[model samples]
Target chain A: MADRPVSDIELKAPKGDWRDAHVELRKGTFSNASLPKDLIALGLPNPRKWQPTDLDWQLPPDWKGILLRGMRERLAKYRSFRLFMDVCVRCGACADKCHFYLGSGDPKNMPFARAELIRSVYRRYFTLSGRLFRSLADARDLTEDVVKEWFYYFYQCTECRRCSVYCPFGIDTAEITIIVRELLSLIGVSTHWVTEPAANCYRVGNHLGIAPHAFKDALDFARDELRELTGLDIEIPISRKGAEILFVMPSADYFATPHYYTLLGYMMLFHEIGLDFTVSAYASEGGNFGLFHSNDLMKRLNAKIYEEAKRLGVRWILGGECGHMWRVLHQYMDTMNGPADFLEVPVSPLTGTRFANAASTKMVHICEFTADLLYHEKIKLDPSRNDEYVVTYHDSCNPSRAMGLLEEPRYVLKRACNHFHEMPAKTIREYTFCCGSGAGLGNDENMEMRLRGGFPRAQAVRHVREAHGVNLLACICAIDKATLPTLMDYWVPGVQVAGVHELLGNALVMKGAKERTTNLRGEPLAKETANA
Target chain B: MATPATVEERWLAAAATVSGGLIAAHTLTERDPFRNPIGHVLRRNLAALVREFFGAMDEAAIDAAFGEIMALRSIQDLSVERAVGFVFRLRGIVREEAPQMQPAEAEARIDRLAISAFTQYLACRERLADLKLNEQLRALGVARRRTAHRGGAPA
Candidate 1:
């Protein structure tokens, strides 16, 4: 019977103030369950072989009590959590700001609704008004079902904070998501994707769990790739004492593609300028998954960078390209682990450009350093080397909205590539869409959700692809470089993705370098053919 | 039962119904404002698909509309019954709105559209899987190149 039920369909919009729209809890909607082994690997205390979608989540006997108590503890510990739970007037300004809502059309994915998922639960448990008038106050009891809802929707958020940018009261869903996750973690109810990385970052000082010697070997491989491309052997000192600057990068940059090429670019730039920098094997990773989980976990993983910096006796720290890594360094690190009065303020060695913005943390972004280097005419560049790529810059969420790093990456992209195009005015800079794979959501099992979350971003990229024939999507975030290529291939075919450093690697004119036939990925340069 | 008077009302009613279901899937757990860009596209695509299936436009137009829907649906975690169910939603709309429609002919058209839409959804799904594989391969390729360079390094 192909008589698909389109009859008797009465379509009516929710009435009487959209904020009072009926909240439904339809079962079987969320089924992408987290695995038990992943939880165990992340060092979570949960029974093995128990999945989230199962009728029995194998949660502790007093799970409901644990969650309520945990929420109460967090509310006291974190003022932002208490303030965010109380301050929302349901104004609805932030409803559409979430890329998840824009891409998925799921009203629950809306930032306001997503926050309400937790706020409603908060009211039922904590506030007297909520207990007095449950329905009117939009409060619901914390039940087994409510815990399941938390596990499903809280993990869906990339915690990009685009909503906070537009919120009148500056209510941050990212903070809400983080606190909810912390409460979930107290009950041993968290996604394997996030916990596994947090576990690895804690134990190995990197997310990929690469060992010390293996990390060195990967850097050695990158150094050799640089030597092959530039014909100059650049020394990459690892964990060397008395190095003036301690350089830390996302471990993905060492082992992963497109990212590795950018790693090579860093080597080339440091080699060209003869900057005194040392990358530590211990402080190998810059991206922190702990930020996605809890504030204390973030500080635990982030402490290694400063630890290595002080151990190496470096004057200052220079961080490589990443999204949340910068967010942690800029906003959280100094507050959590600092009085890094042990380290001096960072100044660009080539141009003597003091990073006034990073004076407190004493960590400078590589883009800021490179942009300053280019501004002072320190490095020789040939923009035509990247002529094949009509580039567009993607402002990563943490970098732009969190740290206000809007212009530095574009400054580097403009000088490194011949043709640069900006996406729609609304989509670029402060209003940038996420790559849909940030905050430890870059797992293969959840590709469908990731793609949905990534659609608004892919749509903006598709805009530039059609308008300017932009083949290259350049960004400063390592996650963007890793994930956007896949997003481009799926949504807008023919668009390539790379980091700004990869473009710089292609365009940098190294001294005594052999005649080049290829770009960073070992593809032949389009300009080389024309020049010949 | 009587259908709407004008072609515009008929199509608009059909679109409103189809998009309303698509929007409801997102609100399975909670409800908020029922407006979004995805809903707008779903509405437009439904109208365009109705036009194309009835020979007002070519198959390319149907394909384009289905392509957009497939892209949006692919990212959603929906089962086969749910994912391709929207394509066949037009069958009831045709039964309601189309004047003097033969049930057999309408079923055939709806079946054909479902098959085409399913094929499009599969293609998008396949591309996502392949891109993931390609990403792994690309990382391997970069690693291999790095290894080769490391070996060729002057001692």
Candidate 2:
């Protein structure tokens, strides 16, 4: 690491005086330098070392042509793209709603302002009013500064769609960000946090780039840990042919802390229910970083799951707890790479419930699957096992807004734990704040922005922490599992982050299992108190 | 004979003027803590600082209150002077609110608070720098481990 004093670190201080605070772009909030190797290996255009702060981004000579052409193509193809561009009226309903704006107090971080970075360019090239009136119509010529602004602001958005919930015209600002990012990718303006993960997901089948053996080793480690805690030798099938269900999750589930405990939860739950499922090494990652990049790349990376399902001959798919994975799978997967007629409609073998919501997609969320199980009383849960935790659920953005997975995780959480609290009405469910690090912004260099963006969510968690002595934050997204821990550590120091399934695993009562003394983390469980 | 609450209000008003331009007027006035965490953080910390200065002069409590505000301002797009200068703004508020208090003692306390605020601001900046370095190292470590598992040269 470079040994530089904190005072010496260059911050992109906002230009002009404090009155310009609204448009002030902070230092350290822009895209990190993309690794040349990752960019080159991915076959991205103009693969070279570039930082967002550089004066000249070394754009292709016809960069304007590329952006306009990309925008025109998307405008013609996606009605939502065209509609979002044309519909926004500069209303500020979404201004205060955005967690980034609320956190940073930067007006440019507001959804409308962020969209205007692209909309102004869109107007100049595509609309007649912009062509004639230009500056009067609030349009500007597409310039390098505009492209740099796009790279900075678009990456700041998690594409969480919280703004869409508040838009009167229902302009999906997240889609605008997506289109702009796709356009920027054409000029090789992408972040390492995104490109590296996209490359890994493309080649190694997971964002962590964990090879097949390493994937198995992580699972094996979880299995040994589980056995030590529960004394049940759970079978974790990998790429088993003719399995009834093909299980897929964000690679972090098996590889990272907190998410690993959720992995154990899934294993124990599947074992208790006697469900036949196999995890595929080829389709190891459910979370698609490509969604943060370009649509074509997203489609390319997403094709692996159905292909893996076909190769394994699984009847249906059971997805693990992931935020954007569900967003892509629920919203974009079938349209992009589907006609998944090869797989059957997902039916819970334990509860005999058919997931008609996932009929066409043929993939059921683990929370949905578990909620169905708990509803039908298929798995016995000892809620007291989780009495030590006063839990609060954070609705991970994509899961709540993009996929409308509002109640299932909460339903499961209620059954799995004795003490449960909700973070105030506005901050949960559809109006949920992004973890601030989602959509490939979860990298280390973006730590300051992440903390700022996550301020709203952390503040809510702090509310419940003080109100109810809540010490555990439960969520159903893998990114939430990975990032909320850092947010909680920074803001609400005593609170811990855990997956919903991890909590359920703590409360699960497996037959012939050893007397449990601890939760999945091997932390000793709260001793039973006598009331007699 | 201003009560503690009255003095705290005066001190907060002074701090707000220094930090006010950083956020919108509406956001600075937003009562909802979750909606305007920066405003909430500022109000909460400034109040705590006022209480510490007027009350028992608990060095630790005063340091923590200053640290909380500085932690936020350090990460924001403020120059070091603008970030910590709010502490110095409290001097006039203290003089007007407590005329019976010793001018020399109050000045000494305010001076000490300003220095502590600057120290806290630097510490927070260092924490941010460390966070960046640690995140990069963590990512590199993960990449290296993955490469080693694949029996390839480390990435």
Candidate 3:
């Protein structure tokens, strides 16, 4: 039973070519999606390996009703609905903003067009004419056929929240999409990645199927890498209760490639600042995949983070800059799991400035934290040591659009490295395009469409590489870490992807530790930030 | 004679839920997307309504959704405004007859019944799609002029 997770594994690269993905998508046949199968599955698609063995649903039964009512009423009452309903003139100002529309030339991919899909329902359900007459002006009804179409398209959304940024009224359709996904979960339907990790997190406490011993071993690996890279005896301050900070990172880091190295970078940063931070084996997973499945599961998955936080009695909780994780944190975290009292909003000890808006817990993005420390001159300098290659930044969709984390990362890169190149505005900073793989679309199930969507962003990077000799691409989100390698290798050849914190690790002047490898040791030192 | 609400009010009342400016903007233009957008709006909304109904509503979720609907205390206070322009603009003989029948109690009941029937009809149409089987929809008859949906997934 213990080994069930390990034996039941299958990780295939997404099938089909991405360019043709949109073509197949337009036809509803490209991904070979099965509506019936999806409807029957509970988040995890492949039940044998993915089905959670942990029956430990430990809910108080009544808590489910409270959460459901709380979220439902809040959504039903959100001001954004009114804003979305009232805002768009449909002048098509947003027609070109979407990566999917630009990539496929499909007008339906327009953000307003998608919003209308929900807006129309809102009209039908709420208006007197929709209710009392055949008036074309009001509400509509939910039909089974309508369910299938939503299942198909809602999954396509990538939930980028990009549309919200450009919407003059701050209308967030991503909320609508999340609500729809919650509704879908109620029907016992879910995709594998969304459900699988959620179950893994609940069952084993880590999404990578790691036990405590394995988790400890991963930490040891990071420590050894720290020794080789920094020539220092840096132990990852592992799982100690009553620490000042409980840093939460995506489990993918502990189980996968550069994520481990990114962890090492944080450890070095923590040690340098003389802060008390601990990793938790109880709630090790960062809970990004929670939003991908059902909001019911999203909340269920999110609840564990606070549960552990309280159990450990930490003053501050730091989160890694993961894409969906930030989306949940920035957009829904406060509304769902909040009133976090022990933490006083992450303020840099060096800068005396707040890490982020109080709305998204006082937690700081690693880049923001590192940059603040640098700005305050808390770290010793050797900025030009990373001068070997020109670099550019891929502003991840979540940090830039969802939370407006544009300048802090660029600030870090500018100060940490010697040669810095900027991608065109459309590809960098606030207007930065999504990596073709935002959302779970990076999966092999839809990799074909992912590749196509990735084209424009890849082309943007290609231009920087050709025009400015850019070799390293720094982004803060871990999902980007998993995805950009493919994008750079396939489209923007000769460039590598990295965490902003990583580039800082190379030049960081540790008090007790020697300077580490140029790249954060998330992977072996051989894996340069450049494309393989 | 009971006066009905203006067509604009009837439209805005519900259009108020999703977006006001977009709806108001559409009100200014004769060819607005709400009335007739480039893609099929009716199909799109119907899909969303179902997605919302099921994705968010179990029996408990439905009750919660219903509770929310009921919670809008103002909705109950709203007077059912008639579309006087629509009544006046009715085609041919009915246009003249509708105004002529003015204030008759019988006409008012029929009008009320029609409103109830229409609202119920929209809900019935939606539920038929949700249940899908004819036997499941024993109350909604094929003889009832009902349209069979293509089920929206790839045929």
User: Which number leads on DockQ?
Assistant: 1
> Model 3 in CAPRI terms: which quality?
incorrect
> What TM-score would candidate 3 get against the native?
0.64
Write one digit per residue (lDDT tens) for candidate 1, span A1-532: 1132233334344434433433332232232334665556555655355556577777888888888888889899889999999999979888777877777666677788888888988998799989999868888877777777777777779999988888999888899999998888777776666777777777788888889988887877777777777788989999999988999888878888778888888988899899888998889899998898788788888888888888889999998999999999888888899868999988887788888888889999999899999989999998888888899988999999899999989999999988999988777788888888887777776676777778778878877888899888888887887788888888788998888898998999988888778898878798677878
Q: Report chain B TM per candidate.
A: 0.66, 0.83, 0.24
CA lDDT, candidate 1, residue A362: 94
Question: What is the clash count for each candidate, in the order shown?
Answer: 2, 1, 30
lDDT scores in order: 0.77, 0.81, 0.55
In model 1, the clashing pairs are A24-B29, A26-B28
Residue ranges of candidate 3 with Cα displaced over 4 Å: A1-79, A82-87, A129-142, A345-356, A511-532, B1-155
lDDT of 1 at A423: 87
**Per-prediction DockQ:** 0.30, 0.27, 0.01
Model 2 agreement with the true structure over A1-532: per-residue lDDT tens digits: 0012112323343335321212334566665867888888888888887677666778889998998889889999999999888888887888888888887777678899888877787888899999999878878888777777677778889998898899999988888888988999898889898888889988889988999998887777667677888898998999999889999998988876677778889999999989899999999999898899989889999999999999999999999999899889988999998869998988888778989999888999998899988899889999888988999999999888888899999999998888999999999999998889988888776788898889889999989998999999999887787778777767788898899999999999999999988888766777733321
* Order of the predicted models by lDDT, top scorer first: 2, 1, 3
Candidate 2, superposed: residue stretches over 4 Å from native: A1-27, A528-532, B1-23, B92-102, B129-155
Index of the highest-lDDT prediction: 2
* TM-score, prediction 1: 0.89
lDDT of 3 by residue, A350-456 (tens): 56776557534656566667777777878875665566658888888887887788888888888878889887765666677787665555554454345445555
- Give candidate 2's error at residue A255 in angstroms: 0.7
Largest TM-score belongs to which candidate? 2
Order of candidates by DockQ, top first? 1, 2, 3
Clashing pairs in 2: A12-A27
